[model samples]
Each structure stands twice: as C-alpha cells, then as structure tokens.
Target: MPPSSALRRFFVCPSHRAFTLVELLAVIAIIAILAALLIPVAGAMRKKARETRCLSNLKNAGMAFFNYQAENRDRFPPACERSTGSWRAFDTLLGYTDATAELLHCPLDEIPRVRSLRPRSYAMNDPLWQRESWPGVSLNDMDNPSRTILLSEWFVDGNTTGSESYCDLGNPGTFAHANGTAGNVLWYDGHVSQLSSASHDTNQQYYNFR
Candidate 1:
C-alpha cells in the first residue's frame, strides 16, 4: 500500500523550491540598497513638483489681474492695503479673486499662512507703500497697471524701502539645497520669471518696470 520510491523520486515536494535563507537575505539587502538610493531622489522630485505648482498659482493670479483690468476700466486691482491693516485691500477684493488659499501660497514659503477661509503664500504690494497708484492718484495711470507687481514669493524683510520684499528661491531650510537660488515673480504683464541669486536685487532694472 506504501507509495513507490520511483514516484517519490519523480515528484519533488513544493517546499524544496523555497529560497534558502542566504538567498532571501541577499534579495532583501539589494531591495534595501535600492530604497536607500531612491528615497532621496523621490524627495527631490516631490520638491520640484511643489515648486512647479507654486509657479502655476502665480501665473493664474497674474492672469486674473489682467482680467480684473478688463472689467475695471483698465485699472489693475488695488494692492493689499493702501490705508488699512495688513491685507484690507485683498480682503475687499476677495469677491474679485478666486480667494482660494492655495492660489495665495507658494511651496517655497517657510511661513505660509493657512486661514480658515483660504491660505496665502504671497502678499500683494501696498499702493501706499509700494509707490503704485491708480488713475486718480497719478498722471501715470497708463503705466500703473503695466508697472504694478502682480505676485511674488518674497517673504523676507530686507533693505528694500517701502513694501518691497525678498524671497528665498532655495529648497526647504533643512536641505543642502537651501542656498537661495531663484524666486518666482509674476509681473503686471501676466508673465512669470525665475530670478537667480545675483538677481536677488529686485531693485535692479530686470525686476523693475524700466
């Protein structure tokens, strides 16, 4: 009644096909090494994606400004605050802007504010502080909209007089890429440009309306 030795020899058990401990350990080591190499790359990719999103948001805001002019008799939207608190102008224009918090924030911002209504990554120039004015205030009304700053990631306090600010174009503060590289600037013309370290001088001709 016992099974024949020939049958047992012909059919090897499935358990015998399993990997040996050494082989399994080798495979695990290779996987661990691969993960170690890929983790950093994946992190960098994520950061770049965030930066791209930030730029897109800025472009949308710039486009919105031009659209605002079309509806407001060729005058750009008012700056953040001309006579009131930190963001009264923006608050008033909420009906005009998409008012979505994400549109106002930049991924490179270290202190991006998230509000109950929306989050903000950048701040608009204050006409009173930034020297930009509408037709009623300046004879240069034609130039106001063209010269006004639409959006910026500059969140630092510097020697810039009035409301001018400097932005950090570098990676997250904790990373080696933290050296200030380039910042995103959305001009009144609805154009976006990346400025480098030497270009950090926003007062320079490149950033100025000149």
Candidate 2:
C-alpha cells in the first residue's frame, strides 16, 4: 500500500486533471478554423488533380491521332467527313489508341453536349468548314505542327462541328472546366498543353495549318 501523501499526489496530478470548458472550447475553435482553412484548399487540390487527369486524357488522344496518321498515310481523320449517323469527331480515334474509351473523356466535363454513348469530352478543330481542307490536308502540309490545334477540351456535337467550328477559344464558356476557365489543347504534333482561352485569335498564325 502507498503512503497517504503519495496516494493524494497521484490522485491530484495536474497532468491527469480534466480539461476546463474554456480549454475544450479553444481546442474546438482551433479545429474549426483549421477545417475552414483546409476545405477550400482541399477542393482546389481536387480540381487541379482533375485538370491533370484531363491533360493526360488529351495526351492519349494525341497518341491516337499520331497512330491514325501513321496508318492513314500521314493524314488526320476527317473531323466531319462522315455523311452518316451520330458519330462525334473523336470517334475517329477510338480503335487507333489502345486506351479504353475512358481516355476520350475529361474528368472535368459536366455539361456534355453530346450523348455518352461514344463518351467524348474533347472537340477537334474544324478546318473542313473554311476550305474543306481537313482530312484532305496531310500533316506534312502543316506549317507549324506544334502550334496548330488538333483537339481541345470542349463539347462536341455530331460527327463534326465542335469547339468553335473554327478553333477560337474566345467564348466565355468555350473551354470551361468544372470550376472555372481551362483549355487543354492537343497539338497537331502530338503534344498536350494548357492554353490561355482568351489568348487565341481564330486567325492566329498558330491556328494556321498551311
């Protein structure tokens, strides 16, 4: 048995004392502040992650275009050359890439213009409308392949007619992400980049293929 003094000291130890209400409230307040600070940060992180994923998907789509070009005599598939059913332009890349159909979808895509039957979230630049010079013009004819837009994160309509019908990112909602403005561009040279939406003019040299 311990001495009475030792028992009293043990029972009354400050370290073992219960927390005061004020202390508890302070701790809770600190936690609440931390959560308040972290929530938006966490959301921003998630949005950035989805943006990265969307870029990766565009990269895969670029690969598919390259592969399609390799087999199609260096010519890109027609954006809307099809005279038939409800096929979107990206469908022209389906079998060319080993990536599943999921690669064609952007994680940030919410306002899809077309049905999910073919599951596409990117739209091709339409050179076919201006001079009927899209799939007809081979990649060899491109002046600056690195700058020429091939595909972008946007909504697609039918087998053709996407993004802007001209590759202009001037619209407010043209290249929208889940949160705000974002434009993920896949160039003709098989590279992916985040481009400024308002930075491009429809007739900019970068948009010119010839």
Q: Which structure among the candidates has the greatest lDDT?
A: 2
- Model 2, residue 193: what's the lDDT? 80
In candidate 2, where is summed lDDT lowest over 10 consecutive residues?
164-173
Error of 1 at 131 (Å): 8.7
Candidate 2 ranges with C-alpha deviation above 4 Å: 1-15, 81-85, 116-119, 128-136, 155-173, 177-182, 205-207
lDDT per residue (tens digit) for residues 75-138 in model 1: 5544532232245334544556775645666766664343432446655544422322444122
Model 2 scores a TM of 0.73
Shift in Å, residue 16, candidate 1: 1.3
> Residue 171 lDDT in model 1?
16
Candidate 2, 100-130: lDDT as tens digits: 8789778877654434244466666666323
TM-scores vs. true structure, each candidate: 0.69, 0.73
- Top of the candidates by TM-score: 2
Q: How accurate is candidate 1 locally (lDDT)?
A: 0.54
